[model samples]
Target: MQQTVVEHMDRVAEDVVALTLRATAGDLAPWDPGAHIDLSLPNWLDRQYSLCGDPAERDAYRVAVRYDPLSRGGSEYVHRFLRPGRALGVSLPRNHFPLVPAPRYLFLAGGIGITPLLPMMRAAAAAGAPATLVYVGPSPATMPFADDLLRSYGDRVRIVETGRHGRPDLHALAATLPADALVYCCGPATMLAAAEAAFPAERLHAERFQPVARTFGPDTAFEAVCARSGDTVTVPADESLLDALALSGRPLPAGCREGICGSCEITVLDGTPEHRDDIGAPEGRMFPCVSRAVSPRLVLDL
Candidate 1:
C-alpha cells in the first residue's frame, strides 16, 4: 500500500479526468506498460485504472479516469471528491494485459479505453517498433488523448469518431494485419467482441473494464469442499462463492469484485465451474468473486 497525494487533476476530455499523484513517503514502484493500480476510495470501493504515463518516470504516476453516468460510486467519487492535494491509497501495479514482444503491433482503443494503450504505444515507439493505433469514440470531445496521440504519432494514429464519421470498418482493419502482428484492444465489451471476432484468438489481446452479461440457470445452493482443510461450506444462492468461503474462515485474495480483475482466482481440485467473468476462460481455476458452481459440489484447493 502506498499513500499518495493528488498533485494535479485536470479534465483531459469530456467527463474524463487525468490525475497525477506523487508518493507521500518514498519513491513510487516501477511499472511497465499495460500495468494498472488499484485506487482505494472512500466506502471501501476499489477501482483499477491503467498507468498511462511513461514507465521511465518514477517520481509520479498518472492515471486517466472516465466518469460513468451509471457508475457504482468509484468514478463518481473521483470526479466529485478527488482534487488537488487530496490524499488517496493505491496498491502496487499489477499487469494482466502485458504487452508481449512481436514483430508489429495494432492497437484498437475505444473512448477512455485508450488509457492502457497510451503507455504501450509510447513503449513501442521508443523501441523503434512498427505500431499503429485506431482510436474510436462517440465524438472528439469524448475521446481522451486524441490530440496528443495525433501530434506524437502523426499518420500512425487514426481517429474514428462515430458522431462525425460512422463506425470504422473493423473487419477491414483486421484483415490487413500481418501474420506476426499482435492486436491489442481495450474498450467496451462490444468493441472488444468485434476485435475478437475479427482477429485470431491467439493474436488478439484485450482488457475489459466491465463484465459481459451471462445467462445462468436459477441460482441454486451448492457446497464447496476444501481439499487442504477438509472442510465443507455450503454456498447459498444469494451469496457469492468468495463470500461463502470467507464466512467459512477462508478468504481468497480479491481486487475488483465485479470480475474485471482476476484476483479472487482459486484452484478447483474437482468439478466444473460456470465461468462468468469478463477475463474469459479460467483454464483450470475459477474466480470465486463472480463465478459459481455448475455441479452439486465443488472441490477447491483453498
Candidate 2:
C-alpha cells in the first residue's frame, strides 16, 4: 500500500481544479475502466479517486481529484494543500464499475465524472473500437481536459457547453448513437436518472460519484446471513446492511459507501435485494452499502 509520488500536475479550470498524481507502481495492481484507488492522507482521512490514465502502464497510476464547493476537507486539501512528489500510501485498485466489451461504446460525462471515463475513452480509441464521447459542462473553458479530448478524438467527441446554451437534450443523446451500442454515463443524480429513464437497461452502464439519497418510506427491518462466515446479522431500520456488517467487524473493501462505488458489492444468494446503485448490469445482485433487503430474510454470498 506504500507508494511514492512521481508526477503531480494541476489542471485548473474556472470552476474546478484537478490534481493529477503519478505514483510509483511497484506494488500497484492493474486496473480496468471504472476502477479506483483509495488514498490515505496524513490526517487519517482516506478518499477514493478513479484512474484516468492508461491501465496497462504498470510503472505508474494516474488519478485526478477535483475541488468541490460542497466538499468536506478532502477536496479542499487536495486543491489547496497537497503537493507533488510526496510519498503516500494508497490501496490497490478496486473496481466495481467495469467497462463492458461491446462493438461500440457511447460515453456521456458531466463535470468531474469525466475523470473515470477519460481512460476508458482512450483505451477504446487505442483498440480501434468505435466510440463517441458526449461531454456536457458549464462551458468549454470550465470543462476539464476539454481541448485535449477534442484534439485527440476530434469529430467523434462532442462537447456541450451548457453555460452558453442549455441542458443537452436527452432525446438527442438517445438519437445520436446506434441501438447496439453500450452507453456509459457518470454525472449528477438527475442526469443519470434521466439516462436510465431514456435508455434501456441492457444498453446502459452508469456510476454515481455521489450517494443515492434514499427516502425510507416506513420503518423496515431485515436479517442478513453472510455465506462465507456463516454469521447472522440484523439490519436495523436506521442502519444500512453495510454499516451493520462493518459494525459487526467485517472489513468490507468499499468506496463511496453511498452505493455508488461497486466496491462493497456481494452476490445475493436468496431474498429480493432492493437495488440502490446504478453501476454495471443490475442482474439483481446487492450492494450492501446502500441497498437493503426488501424481503424479510436475505442470504448473501459474502
TM-score leader: 1
Residue 298 in candidate 1, Cα distance off native in Å: 4.4
- Count of clashing pairs, candidate 2: 0
lDDT for each residue of candidate 1 in 94-209, tens digit (9 for 90 to 100)? 78899998878999999989999999999899888899999999988889999999999999999998888987788998778888899999998889889988899999999998
Q: Give the 10-residue window scoring lowest on summed lDDT in candidate 2.
A: 18-27
Residue-wise lDDT of candidate 2 within 23-54, one digit each (tens)?
56553667898888887776666788888877
Residue 219 miss distance in model 1 (angstroms): 3.7
> TM-score of predicted model 2?
0.82
For lDDT, the strongest prediction is 1
* Lowest lDDT 10-residue stretch of candidate 1: 275-284
Q: Work out the TM-score per prediction.
A: 0.89, 0.82
